[model samples]
Target: MKIAVVGCTHAGTAAVKNMAELYPEAKITVYERNDNVSFLSCGIALYVGGVVKDANGLFYSSPSELQEMGVNMKMKHEVTNIDTEGKKIAVRNLETNEEFEDTFDKLVMTTGSWPIIPNLEGIDLNNVVLCKNYQHANHIIEKAKQAKKIAVIGAGYIGAELVEAFEVYGKEVTFIDSADRILNKYLDPEFTNLMETEFENRGVKLALNQAVTKFVGREGSVEKVVTTEGEYEADLVILC
Candidate 1:
């Protein structure tokens, strides 16, 4: 039997490893758009806050590890098209810009989620970034180091955590969200209220119940965040 797995994140890595062990006789090929696999994205805040001393520690699995399990690990390979009926897929080698096709008896897709970016003015300006994967973590850490005033445009788990991290790192952080409270979707008002108080005590500015209307920049770099309630000065903006 031949199997093809698209994506090599947590789920993809788990599926590939389990299948490789359960069906030793089967041939498996894993396609990953990124060069690395199985990154612990939840720890991104810790990493950005200097809690995680090594960036390499974020990755739980690697291509070489998967390859050792008798599985073909195709790093930097994207599955451009999948023909389910024909059991074939068109692939592109990102490094070489080469395209090719491969046949598989079975297919598994574990393509993960991406951050939702709003269509706000000046969003594409420098220092406006999204937090989702390994690359974003590194970018945030790098940008946070140079930014005096940092603004995060989401109050979810990641956004709240990032704001706290930035606050501990001595950066002036402004936490913004459309909802009335931080982590409204994940936590109850009681919990969020306490968290809000804690954050406020640490001098982290909370801009809840305000929707971001636009981002203001000077000379192609972000300078301010304009929200429904008010505008705040920001040297770096992170859209969680």
Candidate 2:
């Protein structure tokens, strides 16, 4: 049997590694758009907080490592289209922009969630980014070095943790969320209130119950965030 796997993040990496070990007799192929794989995006905040000194430590697996396990690892390749009935997929080499077809007896999709980018004014300005991948994490860290004030949209785990990191790094942080409290989907008011208080104590401004209407910029860079309630200055913005 021949198996083709698309994506090599948390899910894809686990699937491919387990399959290669369990089904050694079967031919396995892995496709990853990134040059590296198995990055723990959850550790991004830790990296930003200076707990993790090296960004290379974020990745758990590499293309060569997968190849050593007798799996065909195709890095920088994107599976553009999959024909389920024909058991074939159209693969594109991102580096050379070349396209080709590959047949497989079975196919697995481990494509992860994408960061939702809201349509708003000045959204494409410099220093406005989304945090979801290894590259994004690195970009955030590099850009944050010069950012005096940082704003994070979405009060999820990633956003909350990121604000904490920025606060620890001595940057003024503003966390904006449409919800009434941070991590409302995961924690109760009692617990969330404690976290909110802690954030406030650390000088992290909470902009809860406010929906970001648009971004105001100057000199091709985001300078402030406008919401339903008010506007806050931000040299860098991250959408979590």
Candidate 3:
């Protein structure tokens, strides 16, 4: 039996490993857009905040390990199109810019979520990053060290955690949200208020009830964040 997996994130890694163990005679192939797999994205803020000393610790699995387990790990390969009827797939090798096709008796799709980029002015500027993946985490940590004012757009779990991380690193952080309260959907008002108070007490600026209209940049780097309410100076902008 032959099996092909589309992604190599949490579900994909688990599926591929378990399948490789359960079906030793099966030929298992895994395609991953990234070179590394089993990255703990949730620990990005901790990494940026200096809590995680080594970035290598963030990855729980490696390609060599998978290969040793009799799994063909095709790193930096993207499954562009899938032909379910023919049991074939079109893949592109991102590193080599080569395209090819492969066949499988069984297919598994674990393509994960992507960060939604909004159409806003000055969004193409430098130091504006999306909080996802290991590459983005490394970029954020590298840039955060040189940033004085950091503005995070979105008050979700990731954004809130990033704000706390930046604060601990002694950088001024502004938390912007379109909702009336932070974590409105995740937590009740009472808990939200309590966390908000904690944030404020820790010298983190909360910009609630405001929607980001656009970003303002100068010399190819973000300088200010314009919102429905007002403008805030930010050397680095993170969209969570």
Candidate 4:
């Protein structure tokens, strides 16, 4: 039997490794656009803040590791289009700009959610980044070294934790969100108030009820974070 997996991230990697072990006689082909596989995106902020000593810890698997289990892992191959009716697919090799078609007896799609880019002005700024992967962790840490003031949008778990991490690195952080209170979705108002007060006391600005309308930048790098409340000078911006 032959099986084809569409992705190699968290869910996909887990599925492939389990299937390969359970069905040793089967031929497995895994397609991943990234050169590496099985990376823990959740630890990106910790890695950025130096809590994670080694960046290699972010990845749990590699193409060579999967290959050792008798799996054919193809890196830098993007599954551009799928024809489920025909059990065929169109793949593009990002490095060579080459395209081809392949057929499989069984197919699995583990395509993950992408970061929701807000329809705000100046989103194309250079210093603005999304903390979603290992590469992003490295770049965010490098950016923080030179940033005097940083602004993080969204007060979700990742956003809140990042604010605390960036603060430890001596970067002034302002967290902006449109909710009436911080972490309104998670904890009770009392707990949220306590956490919010602590964040504020730590010098991390909490701008609740304020929605960012635009990102002001000069020379393609973010300079100010503009919201309905007002504008705050920012040397770096992080979107979780």
Whose lDDT is greatest here? 2
Q: What is the lDDT of candidate 1?
A: 0.93
**What tens-digit string does per-residue lDDT give for candidate 2 at 183-210?**
9999999999999999999899999999
The local lDDT score (0 to 100) that residue 66 gets in candidate 2 is 87
Worst 10 residues of 2 by lDDT: 55-64
lDDT of candidate 4 over 99-145, digit per residue (tens): 99988889989877677889888998989989876677788888888
Separately for all candidates shown, the number of backbone clashes (residues 3 or more apart, or on different chains) is 0, 0, 0, 0
Better of 2 and 4 by TM-score: 2
Query: What CA root-mean-square deviation does each model show from the true structure?
Result: 0.9, 0.9, 1.0, 1.3
Candidate 1 lDDT score at position 84: 98
Alpha-carbon deviation at 162 in model 1, angstroms:
0.9
lDDT of each: 0.93, 0.93, 0.93, 0.87
Q: Which residue pairs come into collision in candidate 1?
A: none
| lDDT leaderboard ranking | 2, 3, 1, 4
TM-scores of the candidates are 0.98, 0.98, 0.97, 0.96
- Residues 124-180 of candidate 3: C-alpha lDDT, one tens digit per residue: 999999999889998998898899999998898889889999998899999999999
